[model samples]
Target: MKRDRSGHFLMAQNARVLYVPTTKVASSTARLLLAEANGTYRPERLRWTDAPNISVDQGIHNLEVSGLQYFEFLPETQRDHILKSSNWWRVGLLRDPYARLYSVWENRVLLRAPSPWLKNFQHKCSEVLIDGRLDYAASFRKFVNVLRAEPEIFGDDPHFKSQRTHLGGDQVAFTHLFRVDKPGELDIFATQLGQRVGMKIEPRRLNEGLGLKHLDVMDAQTASVVEQIYEDDFDAYGFERVSFPSISPIALASVGETKAINYARDVTARLVQLSQLARYRQRSRYLLAQILRNSGLRRHKKHR
Candidate 1:
């Protein structure tokens, strides 16, 4: 949806942070922080939904364009307004690909759709066997094949040069990019984000929504299978070839609670706004249809 000139400028100036949330990379926690910083933060609405005032026909075309154009969709007057505004910056976080893929699998399992890869993993078994692990090279080969066949499923494109480019467009200049493995890096990132926004943001609950419970308790062989499946992401994101961390049961529970609470809060707010907008659009369309039909009938009567 196209925002008004004033709204667009305000967003560009006050909310320049464009978080390219890649699945399970503490995206919830990052969104929560952004929400607290700006009371009007709507990550889902920005990425998924258009503005309520904007026309659906125009909005669909805007969505089809690349990310760079999407951010500056306002008229020339609005674009100038945003350019003059202060406090504009972009930032995002990344996670270990292998771990993120595992988390994805775990979430799907909870939703009763485990192993989106093989399609039959759900019917096969709740747990995966990982003893007779495939070699990294072989795993990489399979991953490449899948990506080549189904770019949409893997979230890749022919135009994008790299995975990051595919995610955040070529021109988006990020002010900060933190890796999940180095939790401490988040603090530095927060400091920079605070500087840009002109406020101090104490980083807490860094790895919110990520927990061991979500992780499928798999054998070494199964772990290798998943690792192979996500080799490209690993290489792209700079994941070290280290054994997965053993998260204690208590710690896992804490993580789960944090994730649930944060997700509930963020998702609820977004859904409410989306529902209201949808209702408004439906009502507006109904009124327009009625007016158009009456106008047509009036014209026909006059001709007769």
Candidate 2:
């Protein structure tokens, strides 16, 4: 479940832009790219000292530094201004719901890096933890059950929440929107967005390593259930249901070898998660310094 991920939003005042983030749709990569464009992103990935949160350096973050603020974390005054910004570019992204859930399963259960609320969710679902790991195959149906049955429980977690709602639902405030499943649409949006922001944005892949097989785990019943669960996303976003490619049972029926493969896959997933922290740290410090300098000048001019 590429869930709500602490329910964050990104903004870049210098760029006259606001971004509403949805998980498993390349939100992290978008955030970094936006920060770089705003000229305030630090190369180093720092810990969030304010709470038990793993985040980029908060000191050089926010509206002051990066011109980006976490929507849910910001004060109401700031949030209201951004959300209601008609003049600014309000943007959002979406992914196929099935794809998002599969990524979530790989990231949280296999990779062992999850949002804070995910553990509680795991506890409520099936597949008892075995040797500090979840039974990935067993969890999908149960997870979908939870998605349908107790939607309110997933209200805060966008990973599993409807993309329609995360992208502002029927209110539909976004001036620019993109879909991960459609590369051509993404390219068209990126080209136009770059012209508006006065910089080239070559969309880079981020937060991906999982294969397409996540969707195939769905049997007919589960597929129908998920389609219903995310029906809003399908309708609102103009997306169609994905018919995952089915593999023959004989090919996947090797029980002993499958166990080994699952273990290896899980181990690889964990390594990728660990390396991302270092990757975040390597962003250019020039961006952060530029925002600080320009912001200070703006404030000084206002006073004068």
Candidate 3:
């Protein structure tokens, strides 16, 4: 299954919490709450950086770095227990499909969010990357076109992939499912999770996208295309088709808006590249230290 390889399902074995985190769905907040419950939320992980794609609580998505366990890495017996046991709290979150797609466009295309898999999109849908620049409306339209054609071929990145695929299909019987759009749904989930984990858990709004409503940019044609693309999401998650604004061919991002957005994208791309290089150097230093320490130990043992 895609979920097995995607590593979206995280397990807090100590608390018996199985969390399936879908991107752009309050997933970062969910991870924080679960990490706190697991007694593994590292304060040091919270760092200020301009790495566009890295969350504020950095490396929380990484199973090794986040101090969280992957569901797939668990033993078969334990996996069976999580799936079948009533004691385990299996939780999943959902979002409106249209809103989710807009969020992806704003962050990834408009804001030029950096990711390892972003190159795939750039290579395949070259229109999104226009003349070494990102034009907001043009990028979004091109992205929708790519989605309409063959999203499966290159949309493996969790941020833009189908939420249904992230859920691992019918086999994942979630004990608690919350919709981000529905009133009081997340609050109810917080209460249930707090009781289970023996701590107050609040779902905060982390990672806010650009301040623009999806309906603002969504014309009838774009809405129709998006609905078709995410039809499965609408059906599976019970998301009603939202009404689009009356504007035909929604106004493009203003010239000032476009300029500022492209500038931010350029800065972010550079910062992310620097961040990755810094991390690589840090790892090299650690490895060198380890080698020196081990060599010194071996020499001492030989002398003894």
Highest-scoring model, TM-score: 3
For model 3, what is the error of residue 165's alpha carbon versus the real structure, in angstroms, after optimal superposition?
Answer: 0.5
Q: What are the root-mean-square deviations of the candidates from the true structure over C-alphas?
A: 11.0, 10.0, 4.2
TM-scores of the candidates are: 0.49, 0.64, 0.81
**How well is each residue in 1-304 modelled by candidate 1, as lDDT tens digits?**
6443222111222446555444456654555555445544433344455343222222222222212223444576855444443445556577655556445443432222212233433342232213433122222223334444454553321121233533444444555568855758767776766776788886655323334532334334444555565566556667665554344111122344435544654554465567577768878987887887788842333654
Assess candidate 1 and give its TM-score to the true structure.
0.49
Residue clash pairs of candidate 1: 1-50, 1-51, 129-222, 130-220, 130-221, 130-222, 131-221
* C-alpha lDDT of residue 102 in model 3: 84
Candidate 1, poorest ten consecutive residues by summed lDDT: 58-67
lDDT of candidate 2 vs native? 0.61
lDDT of 3 by residue, 1-105 (tens): 444542657888778889888888888778877877788877564453223344555456555445678888778898899998999988889988878888987
Displacement of the residue 242 alpha carbon in candidate 3, Å: 3.3
Error of 3 at 210 (Å): 1.1
Q: Give the candidate number with the greatest lDDT.
A: 3
